[model samples]
Target: MTITKKTVIVTGAGGGMGRATVEHLLEAGANVVGCDLNIAALAELEENPRFKAMKADLLNEAAVQHIFAQTKSEFGSIDGLANVHGIAQHATPIEDCSLAEYRKIIDVNMTSIFLTCREAAAYMKEQGSGKIVNIGSVSTTRPRPGLQAYVASKGAVESFTKALALELAPYQVNANVLHPGPADTSMLGEFTAVGSSVDDTKKEVFESSVPLGKLLQPEDIAKSVKYLLSDAAEMITGAVLHVDGGRNI
Candidate 1:
């Protein structure tokens, strides 16, 4: 847990889990740059000396590069990256899922990671040290029906992170994936099938599916992200850490 004074960039900083991670890292004394397409949710953190909110789209190449460049210019170095931004797929069969819809999900979920990781790797590799934690989903392991596209995207994240770990090992940059299961976020309700009751699906389908019988809190995922970014996990690379409450079992 030695992240004090480190500079970490967190994507999706406006969302439930992302916001939590930003808070946790700031509390741990890390200089945090929170990026999101819309950063209205992070307004309260604007006054914090250790926090910076950047409104940028991860899908844009220039925007991604700017995030890293600005981080370096302001913080002097980038020590860690937490790829907490992502999208959920509505439960829809592949046959009914338009290719356009599939591409959007893949672009946002997988491609965005590519953009950020690629930019981070450049600076990190040069510095000879860094940590990368990409937030995936337990759905890759225990996918529910009609979430084929989402599963595929997250599965790609796991593989990509492993590849990154091996390629960047020589440079002392560690890469890993954190797959969360059935988090109690607004994003969870988005996974419900069309015309289905969101509350019922959360209780009957998502909550009950977890062996722990409780939905995961965003804080649960944030703490793990902190560990993966800290000195304690320096030797950990290419690992899939599940914060899923046994949902993947």
Candidate 2:
């Protein structure tokens, strides 16, 4: 499926999955605007004529609005939004987790998507057509201990995406969520419990949990995003696509 002239905005563009999605979209001949807190990582993508890299804190409402406004002004229309920006919570029991830590995870993972989706929905509704793909965690379905905050945040994302899908269907806009398994990304280290060995956790826990016997790569999730954003998935909305190496099963 070719999205030759489509315009898509991807958050967390500097990170692994985000970068892969941006690259894949560019390869498909789409105009892509990628935003992330780490602007330096987006430099290589800037060399592409069809790619625009923006440095913005997604939690800031003003910054989120600015990105969407700039995209509309530059591209004249927004065809899709891929909410790939999110944070993981370190493994800790709910009682031991601090309020600040919990709130931060919720804000980054859930609220950020809300901000972007709200803006995208308004634009898409006006145009009467659009696509939205939100990145959720496989943990939502297969819970891991000591990750209460993180799991809860992703659960909110799944529910919110479904609500958006139903509400926006009349306008021909589609909303869906992608639940990824244990992805082998830098962020994987961040999910380990305090003082736990990241490498050991990867081998003994994460990798072992996947029935496929390997962790997911960034491109694995990107390919799924490509299909969801393409015409091939026009009938798929409010669906949770688990690209998780059978982890959900």
**Highest lDDT: which candidate?**
1
Residue 97 C-alpha lDDT in model 2: 94
Error of 1 at 214 (Å): 0.2
Question: Which lDDT tens digits does candidate 2 get at residues 153-233?
Answer: 999999999999999999999999999999999999988999999999999999999999999999999999999999999
RMSD of each: 0.5, 0.7
Q: How close is candidate 1 to the true structure, as a TM-score?
A: 0.99
For every model shown, the clashing-pair count is 0, 0
Which segments of candidate 2 are over 4 A away from where they belong?
none
The models' CA-based lDDT, in order, is: 0.96, 0.95
lDDT of 1 by residue, 96-202 (tens): 99999999999999999999999999999999999999999999888889999999999999999999999999999999999999999999999998999999999
TM for every model, in the order presented, reads 0.99, 0.99
Error of 1 at 45 (Å): 0.3
Strongest candidate by TM-score: 1
